[model samples]
Target: MMGPAAMLLLLLLLFPVASAAGSRTLVFILAGQSNMGGRGGATNGTWDGVVPPQCAPSPRILRLSPALRWEEAREPLHAGIDLHNVLGVGPGMPFAHAVLHSHVLPPDTVVGLVPCAQGATPIANWSRGTELYERMLTRTRAALAECGGQGKLAALLWYQGEADTIRREDAELYTGRMETFVRDVRRDLAMPDLLVIQVGLATGQGKFIKLVREAQKGVKLPNVKYVDAKGLPIANDYTHLTTPAQVQLGKMLAKSYLATL
Candidate 1:
């Protein structure tokens, strides 16, 4: 019988093309809703597939596929993970790229990005018992395990709240739900001090945008930080971040990530 790791590897459709010696990987989880899942060229019902220069692939970065395999990291990092959305570009790639360029870690360290953000998902959907929450944890654990015990989960990047803004009740409960979500994830992962960098809302689903943004900013979790997306340019629908804005957000995420170190 295959060992657990072996069984997991067998399910992966892509294997990492790592460095010759395979450096230790520092993993980051990109979660939340549409913004974190990216929507760069998405318009109408299709994606234009235009990747920006800043979000380009790098030799030192790899992303965990929806199938749990590690593949060369590329644009639209959440394409396979965020099932319902037409993905174009998200912040994961550019964030990883900026982190690498900043040389925050050792020069040889590899970055593993695990994209688990399902677009249009409400914070309520991420409660402990839900399939979405379970899947996120399962995939994240698998990611840390894949690198032969050499991978470390560095942080989680969250960027949801717009969905909750649609309903007054949801908006009212946003901060408490987010606080619970953060606590739950940190506890379950056995990383109570795990760093979390969350983006404050720039756009929203309804009248509660302000309330939801306040909720995002109000979470007082330790080691948790905030990056505001309020002024970033939006896409055609004035909802999702544009390609350039995604690049900027990636840089912002990198700034926050680097600051933690």
Candidate 2:
């Protein structure tokens, strides 16, 4: 009952939407300090044959390789062995798997991760004015572009604050600065509705940890979600997470993200 011209126009209008619906692509930004960079070792098993239940061939998961390039050790030249040894499983993999299992995405959905993390770097280091943060931002932008542009970015997962806790004044300014950083990242990426997952630091004990948690909770951003790492076990180093604990944390992060979707 439709004219040829009308039908053509309708098809034109719906083409992009239909295509997007058919193949959903999610780009996840993983940025923070050491934890976000993944301190654990790579799995001895092969990942090529592994596929999450929800992932399709077209929209596959992409993770930044050559790990630890972004880890900012005190000397900046320290070997990554220690960091790699403790590395078990981090949040990125589980998050992707959970999204697929949740069935919240379309068929042929691909999830990508762009990790930019540095150890021993304070929140201020990621500030807009700082060179370190600027470099990180540049790298993140490049990674996103390489992955397929803004359409790919579904969320930004952050796990930091340990370094900031070392200083009382920095701790006081953490929340506001974090808010600003999130805003800046959104603006830079030109994605206003991008979800942000802020994982609170897992320091064994202290009022400082509590303050950081309160600050994250008080931020009041609708798209910003918080993950608690309070009771999680830590590595023998007393700061980082053990391999098993990291795996659990990864699962927890995936669950949190899935809940939002």
Decoy 1 TM-score against native: 0.92
**Error at 161, model 2, angstroms:** 0.2
Candidate 1 local lDDT, 121-178, one digit each (tens): 8999999989889999999998887776788899999999889989999999998999
Kindly list the per-residue Cα lDDT of model 2 for residues 48-120, writing each as its tens digit: 2322322222224444433412211111111242133323345566566667666678757766556566666
Backbone clashes in model 1, listed as residue pairs: none
Q: Each model's TM-score, in the order given?
A: 0.92, 0.71
Which ranges in model 1 have alpha carbons more than 4 Å from their true place?
Answer: 1-22
